[model samples]
Target chain A: MGPITGEQIAEKLSLTRATLRPDLAILTMSGLLEARPRVGYFHSGKFPHQIVAKKIQSLLVADIKSVPIVVSEKCSVYDAVVTMFIEDVGTLFVVKEGGLLEGVISRKDLLKTTLGGQDIQKLPVGVVMTRMPNVLFTHTEESVWSAAWKLITHEVDALPVVRKVAQPDGSDGYEVVGRLSKTNITRLFVELGEGN
Target chain B: MGPITGEQIAEKLSLTRATLRPDLAILTMSGLLEARPRVGYFHSGKFPHQIVAKKIQSLLVADIKSVPIVVSEKCSVYDAVVTMFIEDVGTLFVVKEGGLLEGVISRKDLLKTTLGGQDIQKLPVGVVMTRMPNVLFTHTEESVWSAAWKLITHEVDALPVVRKVAQPDGSDGYEVVGRLSKTNITRLFVELGEGN
Candidate 1:
């Protein structure tokens, strides 16, 4: 029921109080139950899964983000593809001078362009990239869980990790600092599973 | 210390046993310490991270795999890319008669093939696909952790979830049943963080 004494539980289960003490200790310690010196045990209303969730939510994107591969907005699609191959990343951040993010390009975008029969060697990535305002991004302090949520909700493979900077014109711009990708999330998943 | 009674521990800390019981309950319950009647408490040599690892490692590929997108090996590279877009999947499983896995193809492969300037409409996917025995796969019973490990180690975006079936010719062939991808892992990570 609401709260039961150790003796009552022992009697109900036909076991000695000594035999039940360890189990009660474990339940209380895990936050599944609350134990009091004189009072009985009360359910703590906490689940074991919450412990895992709490642990995961505490991790920041800054701790796990990978080095972002960048290309110039004026870079040819062919050269962008070459950069992608050289860096072995699925998505690339298109940046201007000072590493300010301009747009984002993905393998899917390049594939579609190639299928268009366009002259990829001459086509600037700016023509095909997802532009700055449309780009989804994360900050260094954002929780990895929220970043992973963005990746799932936006249905994008990666997000450029950015820092806000004032441009010469006094406009706010994002400077690419890192990258958060499904690959990074998967790697983190594996690392967590390995208890590292 | 090796082993000590709660009374002894409380005495050493200059706290009453009554004040120490809850702390002791939590430590013993979380398995940082082992409690025994008469004998007292001993270190359990368990870390909290191991709990998270054990929870993750217990998840299976079958529990989280997604429906696989498939195509005939004779399917054109152009058609394969179309199927990939239509199905909204980054990877495709190439299968032959009886739904046996023949090969695997990814957006990266299609992108590379598209960049080659070859006639994609006439180029069969089999020519560019990663052939069987070279394709990395996972079974239903394999741990998600191990499968995620495979994804990282092999540097593939997705894996065919398969079952070994006895062919009519007495050859053992893998029948593609599902797909496991970085997206799935990311989704799982998000779900875990949500405490679901």
Candidate 2:
């Protein structure tokens, strides 16, 4: 039916209009149906899961990103590990003067370097870090769902949230703004479960 | 108003009953209002977020847990790291005969040990792992929301999904069954966003 009145639906189902009201209300509220003023109801062409997807996608990274833990490219791998411990973060952005992101280092990278039997005290993190253009990142304006997708598809524990900045060389550089991580996603999941 | 009819609500708002149907349906469907046959609508005493929370809380850990990556207690830290790399997991469960959980080890724990300048190749993972009775764990029947909450509260990357088994000594032992990690939660978040 293009549009069906409440009374017509109630009559078709052999239900009183009052008994049918809640059912129609549920369908409309869940976006499975749309009711027009004086025109009755029809399919909205949207599924119930789309409501959840829309809610999740509407959340921006800026709303939930954690403070970015940063280290200098010249920082020794030993110091980088120490910083990671002190900051209690899985990933750290390698930043230069003015907090411009140069690269990103993760616990996995440091662990692999440690297992290599190299002198961590002498090796700078820059050598082991995933350098710019190779580093996967997100912007504040991006949706949290998109960031989470990137984290999953790329198999990285975290992404540096950045803002574009015009560099002295006339190319664009990312200014480290925050961090989006699996931890943040887990926390958000908990929050959603809590009805927050 | 208790058990007010749609016509009464429409009259109160100076709108036709046809125009008021969708609004009432939204309120009733979101669980803020209850509709009963011949009784009209009444307050449900429920918040909208509760609907989302209930859906999330009903998801069980067994439905989404990943296969557990385990190692024996005598396994060296070097080999444990290698297993972690090969399995592509962040945490490893230390188990013994019958697949019982002995302890849990994380990349963070291994990284800290590496920085201590110890002989990782000779250091048994058992020496560095968070041992039994101290490890926080989850079971197959536990809700995913509760498991995610533990991940955030305990600041651990993963939790071993275990089951209680009666030991020969009249004690309870936990058999490692699966793994629940922040990665799982992130993946779930993406799945929800995709409306799957």
Residue-wise C-alpha lDDT for candidate 1, range B109-193, written one tens digit per residue: 9998998888999999999999988999999999999999999999999999999999889999999999999999999999999
Q: Model 2, stretches more than 4 Å misplaced?
A: A1-43, B1-47
lDDT of 2 at B67: 98
Error of 1 at B165 (Å): 0.3
CAPRI quality level assigned to candidate 2 from its DockQ score: acceptable
Q: What share of the true interface contacts does each candidate keep?
A: 0.69, 0.71
Root-mean-square deviation of Cα positions for candidate 2 versus the true structure, in angstroms: 6.1
lDDT of each: 0.89, 0.89
Which 10 consecutive residues of model 2 chain A have the lowest summed lDDT? Answer: A43-52
- lDDT, candidate 1, equals 0.89
Who wins the TM-score comparison? 2
Give the TM-score of each candidate: 0.81, 0.83
State the lDDT of candidate 2 residue by residue for A43-106, as single tens digits.
6755445666767888999999999999999999999999999999999999999999999999
Flag clash pairs in model 2. Answer: A25-B25
DockQ computed for model 1 against the true two-chain complex using alpha carbons: 0.35
